[model samples]
Each structure stands twice: as structure tokens, then as C-alpha cells.
Target: MDQTTTARAKGSRKPLWTKDFLITALANLLLFFSFQMLIPTIPIHLSQLGGNNVQVGLVIGIFTISSLLTRPFAGRALDILGRKHVLLVGLTICALTIAGYTYIAAVTLILAARFVHGIGWGLSTTSLGTVIADIIPPERRGEGMGYYGLSNTFAMAIGPLTGLWIMQSYGFSYVLLISTILAILSICSSLFIAYPKPIPPTNRAKSQRFTDRLWERSALLPSSLLLCTAICYGGIVTFITLFGHEAGIPNVGFFFFCNASMVLLVRPITGVLFDRKGPEWVLLPGAAFTITGLLLLSYANSNLSLAIAALCYGVGFGSIQPALQAWTISRAAPDRRGAANGTFFSANDLGIGLGAMVLGAIANWSGSYALMYRFSSTLIIVFLLIYGWSIWSYSLHKKAAH
Candidate 1:
């Protein structure tokens, strides 16, 4: 009926798949594949290096902590230095650091490499959402983002399984070599995409001191909510193999296989849901799915039960992750989108680190992965309560304002 409404509808019709979008999506795939390939292999490598559960958790988690520290800086760089430049530097760092792993044998050296690797991960990944946001039509942001996120989702499905198979056949060095190649391919892909020109900060924003530039406060709530899921994920990534061994399952790769497949299948639908129904509805079910999966994991005795658990977790993760990221973008001001992404990722990395270390400690103390998983499952319940309270409070605030 209204001219503005008509214009907005037309804008939303802008094509989702452009040349630049394809290049960026491929670049995202390569980047995530390089990282995801190592997710399970690294813990196994650490175990071979004679690390205890706690030490293994620490090594696994320290990467996220390192990445977390660099995210704010990376966000700032994306805004000021430009996305392409920051992304290129990050990719180079990742490629070189991964290559270094082939020569590394000592645990200290391995940890050092992972630390540097995280900086690259933090910088490149922080820019990815920002780049996709810039390219996609604003009205179709949620749908486009869900599609964009599938790059990572698809990689997650294949990466671990491939990496584990390679490690089983060849060695850790070969896995690192393949990861390095993927990172190099990602760098080549990124070069083809024409990145958006960096937006200059406002006069007021420019005047603000260093600390003010460090966060996008508006993104904090969804970021915090995401943290809950990420923590449980870290535990799974870091310890699932050992858990599988304890349960007498010979091949734990099937868990990632099932998990990744479910995520790949469900993510597109969840993206549609975010665009059509909003994030609130998507996130609650996502959380419920994850909790159910974790609870199943705690009680699982057979391969069938484990597969079911993976499927549940995968669907939940697929739904929640993109919706939370879409909500983060929706809440932020345009100029601060990079910062919002950075903040959201930082929260994700922090939760992951905490989960690995904390859950590892629980495993150590209880002497059972089942008990640890049960403990981890409780965290989701806590997060749900917190999320519910926040939603209720926000509703009340809106009513009062009206």
C-alpha cells in the first residue's frame, strides 16, 4: 500500500548468488575446512604427545583464548584497514602456521603454533560475516546469512571425518599438510572477491578512545546466549573420541559424520525460519535439541544411541548458531557490524575455551566422560533459563514503553 513498503519489498528481491558471493562462500568453505579438519585430530595428537585430559583440554582451549583476545583488534582492523586486507593477512598467517605444524613435535611448540593460528582464525572469521553482510541485500540478510553459514556447516561435516581418516592411514603431518593446502586455496579464492570499501567512522566515534572501540554492546545478548552452546561443543570436539573409546566404539568419526549431515540438512530450513518467523522461535528449539543430544550422549552405550545423539546435537547447533548470528547482526548499527561479529565470535571462543577446560577437569575428577557430559548438559538448562528471563524482561520493557 505504501511506497516505502513497496521499495523495501523490491530491495529484498535482489539475487542471492552473485559472482562475489560465490567466491566469498568458497573462501569461507576453505577457511573453515582448514580449521575443522583439525578439530578432532589435534586432541588425538596431544594424547600421543603424552598429555593428560586436563593438559589436552588446555591445549585445545588455548587456541580459542588466543583467538578471543585478537577478535576486538581484528574487528577494528576490518572497519579501518578494510576487509580484504585484514582477511589476506589472516589467511597468510593461517597458511604459514599450519605449515609449521609439519615440523613441530613438542607439545610446547604445538601449543605455540596453535596460538598463532588462532590470531589468523580470529581475524579471518571475524571478517567473514561482515563481508557476507555487506554483499547480501539488507532485506534478505537472515536468509542470505543462513546460506552463507552453510559453507562452514558443510565443511564441518566433511573436515573431521576426512582428517581422521587421513590420520588413521597416513599421519598427523599429512593432515597438517592438507590443512595448509586448504588455507592456501582459501587465500586464492578471497583474492577474486571485490570487497566493499571500508566505512569511515563518525566524528563522534573517531573521537572515542581505544576501549570504546572494543565492543558492540548491542550484540552482547545473543553472543552470550551462543556462548552456552559453544561450551558444550568444545567439550564434544575435545573429548568425544576418548568418550567413544570408553564406550567401546571403535570409530568415533561416525559421530561427526552423522552430526555434520544433520547440520547440513537442517541449516537451510533454520535460515528460512529466521527470515520468516524470527530468531526467538528458532533458538529455543535449537537449545532443546542440543540439550537432548547431550543428555543422550551421557547415557549412550551403543553405536545407535551415539548416532542419534550426534543427529540431535547437529540439528540444534545448525539452527541455533545461524539464528544467533543473524540476531547479532540485526541488533547492531550498520557501521558496527564488523565489531558485532567480532564480539559474537569472541563470546563463542570464550565459551569454547571454558567448556574444554572446565569439562576436562570434571572428566578428570569423576574419571568418566559420561559424568562430564551430564555436567555439561546442565549448562544448557542454565542458559535457557537466562535466555527466558532476558526475553521476558525485554517484553515487559517494550510494553512499558508502549
Candidate 2:
């Protein structure tokens, strides 16, 4: 009956799941599931088409670059246009492009399809992120985002394994067929969601310079941190299959399975921690786990070692990503959530693009995936320094203000 008890009761009653939220989350799961299916297998398909390591990297890089370019416009549109309109358009593009992959026998054609697919990826994901942010009560944003992220986690768990199995048993074209089907299902599920209405731009927002409208300044810090982590992720997803072959391991898909399992275990707990404490509670430890995971991956030569590495990386990745997203959305103005999500994902695309190119070149030059992984892990050191410096500077500013 007292104020503290009353507040706690009300907080506990805040809804995190609703009909629209569930539908959107299901759509996002299918979208990611379709995409994740291609992440590991695409490189192999490209190689079969006579592409080398650098070319494979280029394909991945180009996809992310295209996605990166599309996101700013998509974000602006999500704010000015309605979420449902942008989402459906994006999903339609994705389904079509994924089907196109079935006919791409040449490496050049695959690259072209990937580029187009990335654009759809940018629009749909940005719209989904913004939609979920809008639907979740701010009081439970961290927890809500965590649950939403599980859709991605679940997709990661099975997508690659299923893709690899299909490619081995049926053919690469079958993978494309199934991925296209999943994407179409995503579109169908997305249609059922009751989307939030667009927020009209403020007078100042309308008057802002063109470049200024593309990014949310409040989201930049977390986005930057995310970019550093994503650089390492880019290398892993793109090359892990090849690396497993090089090491004479029979299956690489188990890495994704174990990784997703750990992610599934840690995400909800980390989300609650992030909500109750702060991002620091999760981020610092997450970075350490990621670093350790990459190092383990660098040395891995067998299934057990790979599984260990995957578990560590998954815990770190699952913890850090949702925390950063929640932090970004919580800081941004409600009207600017679309732009904030755009900026956040743009960083992700940029990092992945850069990582693919740079690490691919490294792998090519060194003739060793292990060496490339070692190099990739160092990027997290940069993440930590930036995060630590920000915290230190904030404390200094707080003291000076006092």
C-alpha cells in the first residue's frame, strides 16, 4: 500500500508482450532465419562458382554496403512514411531477391542479388526495430528488446545447420528455395501486425539539414561500440565454414548451434541486469567473453573446441547487442526512434562490410584463418578503450559541474 510497494507492483504489471509485438517478433524471426541460412552457405556457393576468398569477401562486403546505404533513407522514411508501408515494401524486395538466388550461377550475378537483398534487409530490419521500440513500454524496453532479440537468436541456432544440411543433401538451389519461402512467410506474418502510426516531423525536424536527418546523434555512442564488435562477427560468419574445412572438421554448423544456445541462455538474464543496473553491468563482461571466444576460435581445430568458442562468443554477443540497442532507443526521442534504429543498424552494416573485406584480405595474405581470427579479436580492445574513456570522461564532467 505504501509508495515503494505500490510502485513495484505497477512496474511488475507492465506488459512486455502483446498481440502486435508477438506478430512483429515472429516476422523478424523468419526474416533473420532466412538471412542467417545464407550467411555461412553463400561463401561456399560463391566458391563453387569459381570465386576466390577475396571475391567471397567482396560479395559479403557489397551486401552490407548496400544495406548500409539503404538504411538512412529507410530510417527517414519510417519516420515520415508509415512503418507498415515501408516494411511490406522491404519484405517484398527480400522475398524476390532471395528467390533470384536460385538462378544465380555466376559469381557476378550472386553479388548483384546480394546487393539488392541488402537493401530489403536494411528497410525491413529498421522498420521492425522501430516498430518494437514503439510497442514496448519504455519502463520495460530492456527486457522487451531482449525477448525480441531471441527471435534472432533462435534463427541463428537452426538456420545455418539447416542450410548446410540442405546444401549437402539436395543442392544449393534448394537452400535458396527454402530461404525464399521463409521470407514470404515473414511478409505474411508482418501483414497481421497492427503497426504504429508515423510521427510527424517537428518544425525543427523538418528544417534540419539533409545529412543531419539521417542519423540520431544520441544513438551514436552505442552504435560505435556495436560497430567494433560487429567487425569480428563479420569475419566469423563469412569464413567459419571455410575454416572448418581447412581444419578437417566435418561440421561447422555446430558452431552456430552452440553459439545460439549460449545466447538463448544469457539474453534474458543480461536484459534484466541492463534494465536494473546499467549497460556497464553487461557490456564490460561481455567484451571479455567475446575476446576470449575469438582467441579460442583462433586455436580451435576440433568440434569440441569450436563449440566452446561458440558458447563464449554467443554469451558475449547476445548480452552486448540487445543492451546496446536498448540503450540507443532509450536515449532517443520517441519521434526519432526510427532514425536511431537506422543509425544503430547502419553501424552494424558498416562494421560487417569492413570486417569482411579486411579480414578476407588478411586470410588471403596469411593463408590462415586462425591468424585472421587473432587479428579480428583485437578490434574488441578498441571497443573497450572507447567505452572506458567515455565513462571516465562522464565522471569528470559530472565532478566539474558539481
C-alpha lDDT values of all predictions: 0.84, 0.88
In model 1, the runs with Cα more than 4 Å from the true position are 1-11, 40-59, 104-107, 168-173
lDDT, candidate 2, equals 0.88
What does candidate 2's lDDT look like per residue over 1-402, in tens digits? 012222234555467779988999999999999998898789999998899978987777788888999999998888888899999999999999989888768888888888999899999999999999888876667778899999998887888778999999998899999999999999999889888777778887888899889988888999999999988998987789889988887888789889888989898899888777778888999999999999999999999999999999999999999999988888777778889999999999888777777898999999999999999988999999999998898889889999
Indicate the TM-score of model 1. Answer: 0.90
Q: What TM-score would candidate 2 get against the native?
A: 0.89
> Ten consecutive residues with minimal summed lDDT in candidate 2?
1-10
RMSD of each: 3.3, 3.8
| Model 1 lDDT-worst window of ten | 1-10
Model 1 per-residue lDDT tens digits across residues 232-339: 998997788889989888777788889888888888788777766667678889889999999998888788999999999999988888878877877776677788
Q: Candidate 2 has which clashing residue pairs, if any?
A: none
